[model samples]
Target: MKNLSVFSLFLVINISAVFSQNHYGKNGMVASASTYASQAGIEILKAGGNAVDAAIATTFTLAVTWPFAGNIGGGGFMVIHTENGEVTTFDFREKAPFASSKDMFLDKNGKLKSGSNHNTALAIGVPGTVAGLYDAHQKYGLIPWEKLLERAIQLAESGFPLPKSLANDFFQFAEAPEKYPEMQSFIKRDGKVVGFGEDWKQPALAETLKKIQKEGKKGFYEGEIAEALADYIQSQDGIITKEDLAQYEAIERSPIQSTFKGYQLYGMPLPSSGGVTITQMMNMWEQLEETPIIGSVQYYHILAEIMRIAFRDRAKYLGDQDFIEIPELEKLLSDEYATELLEGINFDKAGESTVTEIHSIHEGQETTHLSVMDANGMAVSMTTTLEQGYGVKMQSPDLGFLLNNEMGDFNAVPGKTTNNGQIGTPANTIEAGKRMLSSMSPFIITKNNYPFLVIGSPGGRTIINTVFQTILGTTVYDYPMAQAIEAPKIHHQWLPDRIIYEEYKMAPETLKALEAMGHEIQMRSFLGRLMGIKYNAETEFMEGAADSSSPDGGVAAY
Candidate 1:
């Protein structure tokens, strides 16, 4: 691995064989779930663009190269650290359309309609990706918007070979191809869907990108594309309108900040629960006497307990700050609150769910993350999503992008509990033009007021815990970036009262120990796909790591 260059590893290794690879560079770095997207960002950096320019380029390129999660019709959050030391956050989360109501997913009998918000047309929300990218670029980008979009447009028009990961996604959704004819048409040839290594083209989507490059935000929100979006949605019995598209705007918000072990952590604020949850968990961990031994039963037990406590608060109080009065954030991150929560924990046993107040359902795990840093000291950590894979399984015929099922993220029926034990709460209840609650946590860490780590992930409700563990692994346990990200993870949300972990990742003895402590253990194939970059100013090198579980993830530098 040391002998091979990062780009060389990207080309020579198969997906299954590339997990251990890490990239290092002296100038700049980009880490993402797709090699193509990472390279796109590196290209911008090499061409004299700043971190924001590279991030925008990478994001657009992902829409073309990694469509399963990357999307122009979705929305997300971005945490930015400027070269001059300014920290800001941008919220481009999707909003409920004007015509949507609190009971939209409830039937005439006043019961929640089963699966109405999963893959149906009615699940679509007003998208904000286009607006968000445009706003970020306009404010901080050095290159022209057209230049940043060139690679994505070219990829869409000329086509690229389908990756195995994307092929598997197509196969998984094969049963519902007819439901998303526009997307199917792009991935199919000779009336049959293409598989891995086959050429996949999207001329229609290229045209959409061209319009965006030419007309800016209006290209997506107010003119031909918006008209097509509204028409197709209405035809499918969805209620989004052209007015909703035109009215959408991505707002810039202050990032939530906290400190642990002399490192300052900055993350997205509500409508996302990630930042607060991570801060609370870290604070609780800091109160401990010493770092728990990694991979030990005590390590898993303590982290799980902390996660349960943070998630309980997340469910009880987290919501869109613009619409609901959230608990005082500063207090939540205070040492007193963390110590108070920590005092209730029993080191030998799992605690009972003390939170009776419920919140909304969890967001889908089908989201994407990217981390970027430039030599000038600008950094970005972003996580974007379309809710579920393929979103609502529908696309606008002419616009040629998948629409987000973000409305499904809302709590459709207050007081209802799902199989996962997630209970609905009024704080996240559906409301016209209101942003839905999110678990997408994009974050950046600074040491002595300088960028130290740029990181984020896509794991729905587990995002907060995944990021928390990764940071702990790096900052407290003294693990390198690659090992920290690839290390086995454990998670426990409060209501479920079960610790879900990767099968075979934990030792049998450790499992027995946790089980003895009354932890109900559940096994899963994986937890989250994390992308991160760590900057060592002393060494003058940037180390980039992609989750071992991600199929196409890679790091690029120049």
Candidate 2:
């Protein structure tokens, strides 16, 4: 595998450069929401920073340029594959505050409510994103911390023309700033929401970024920024205290990985139901090697059936294992169990959506994903979030940040019966210091013992389905990354009792066939956003794709 040249890397990153037109070539690859963020990473690589360094730089810059989704105010998870073959998953998802209770969202009659009154304040979790990024950089970063943030600061100070997607998102939550006057100025204009193509600036955010760059993670966690965030929350009659801020920190967790065929799959674990569920789906899919050829009707049927089984298991048995025992996951992915479930599939018919009693809800579904691979073969698949977009719609006026609505992740139907028995089980119910369950699965695949593909997506419960389809498309159907991601995607969460399809992508005949099998179908213009990088480890050439749903998305390979 030949190493990529520095000049080649630059050509791939410069958005205005002619070389930008080509999505892939030889050097390295980066796909993110901001061109400036991507360029910052390329710059780091050119200055001798490794893949991890570039990932850190790109991630930090995103926290600024794309504040609506990715932010320093929120935290997330990252799966890093170091040059030396070390694999680690960073857990920076927000943690339940120390003052939280099991029945926080439960009402007077012990019923659950989903509105902002009980959810807005004190219910928010302590953020781990900053500490998580710092931890990754402390061990793997080559460029200085300040240097990594320079691009973000410049982008913030210069003010970017808001992209159409962000403008739309802002309009959807226009009431946010009014609810929290501290944020009224930026989110609203002339007491009204801003329109698309308008100029949006966050000097407060810029100042905050500069402060963090100057003071490091501590600046945000223990200093003025923390004080402001705490004060503002308190002022709002919320529950986050300075003590919560002080106690927050990200944890380094081992990614749950398994081999499929000859490829290795690495993903986040525990609070993240992604990796285990994905592995279970893969196991079920692997069982169909005999009859239904890949890509045939039988193939689609098998894939859909397997996914239904996996998701059924997910909806019931999976949750924040850090808080509950996800005992079924280990057994679910076990070869014997997978084979047993696979045996249950009737080759001639699509199985019932609830063939198995998998109980995992798609929680904390709002997320953004990125995939990067440098010349050194170090790859990263990361998904960051504010839970749902514009999380909680509450802004810490003094801190210049928005908190997450992760509490919405718990089961709202308290005391309902689950296949496992008892819906309001203590395992997944909100508790002080518990991390919300997540479906952000960042995965990497290896072929012939070398990195082949790094993939992930952001769509709450749909994330697992999206990743499953793409992997099967690429490995079984032999589609390229572009084709794999663009292929029609379907999802069947047991509770929904319907197979949802992407609009106009699935064949009409296929739709008829699915319907004939007693499957209800619904269509949507868009689903989750996915990005992937396929490295030809043998030749060292790579190709990457950023989701087309995101107007700001792009793939650059040097």
Candidate 3:
């Protein structure tokens, strides 16, 4: 069976239609990239859990069901808007081990060592998922911590039905055994292609989850699991150590807040380039005197220019704030300052990009996101990832999990900038214990104390733009959650200076207009996978929208 692409789903969503059918019970709802994980969330919610509890349950399940991105071996960010009016964010992004360096990915000749940054064991970052999720659960979860791991443990032990796409992935391992040697967990003894609907079980993974279920985060970071992770990485010439794993801590940060069209948006700040870049773009958009109607050529042209400027700023100024001071953050995110920056934009012509290097240039659009909202009004939006699909493709023989190549996200060389989108910006230079910069944008929007939307997406650098477009589609154009998610989105990172749009989704006339406006256009089969829940004020319902970009994505709600 062929998967249905969002390009083929063109049903319009008026507010009335959204309220009538898309609405779920006020008790809880979940929108995520995996049906298995989304169902896990609904179960937790029904078991007397809040949104945060459901999110924890969903994340661990995704680690089992959507291994390409979700993982206990990787890390991510979580944003929560509690019903009591508190907004908080957690940064569980992966960090460089103590023995890492700035030139680890560079050769003695000062050139990049091909595949070193992302394809080998050295690319692995210290895992942070356990720490991040545990910290959040400790603070706000309504259910017992071990209970969250039950569904994941059961699936890993008894085996869950493999989706078609995952079967295809296993088949690839069968076809190209040499290229995908690390995929041994899925390798069958008979040497045959794996098919969809087959039971996929992992005894080792079940054991690992049981350990966490018994001992909490320590099961992963301090004892047997830690020893296995460190020993395996070291055997592959990697730098992780037990000390690195033990010292890792997830940090709680203040959520970045901004206003657009009278609605307030709360997003993850700093290490994540998502919040700041999106803030800058939105500020510039609000300042534009010639704001065109949605889907117009003028609309795309202006937004691209805005995206270009914001991304250029991202390259030069954004990073782990703990490592460097971003004195420009306050000014840059200010709407008053945006009015000053827009003075240079011609608006009629596309702007040329001057920034040539990017801290996160190597990241691809391979990550997973989950959005959960409970009856109590707690909304959790989370985005987690490895640098690319299957991460470094290094799965531990004992752990049954794939590790992240997040080190590729840091600047690999000092004082080096490239024409092909590599950069050695000081803010993102590799440093022991420093986190790599990211584009994970998990956000919550509110209108006068009412939670309006719990939203987030995963598309590497395109994530920021995807979030921006989703908000525009919903708030500005009044599209329902699904219609907004399926609508075409565009991305422009200053360097590369090209508009990336979903292939064939744009009108011929719109593309021509953008090209004539001095914009260079490129086509991508898809832009992002977004999981969001829109709050219906009139009906008091939560409308969950799971992106159709992935075949197995679903909204598990009541």
Query: Candidate 1 regions off by >4 Å?
Result: 1-18, 175-183, 354-360
lDDT of 2 by residue, 415-490 (tens): 4545432245345677777887777788888776556888888888788889888888777666667666766678
Error at 431, model 3, angstroms: 0.3
Candidate 2 wrongly placed segments (more than 4 Å): 1-22, 116-119, 171-183, 188-195, 291-296, 353-365, 417-423
Q: Report lDDT (Cα) of residue 452, candidate 2.
A: 84
Worst 10 residues of 3 by lDDT: 1-10
Clashes of each: 0, 14, 1
Clashing pairs in 1: none
Model 3 lDDT tens row, 251-359 = 9999999999888889999899898888888888877776576666767787787888788888888899988899989998898889987887877899887544452
Give the TM-score of each candidate.
0.95, 0.90, 0.95
lDDT (Cα, 0-100) at 169 in candidate 1 = 74
lDDT of each: 0.85, 0.72, 0.84
Candidate 2's TM-score: 0.90
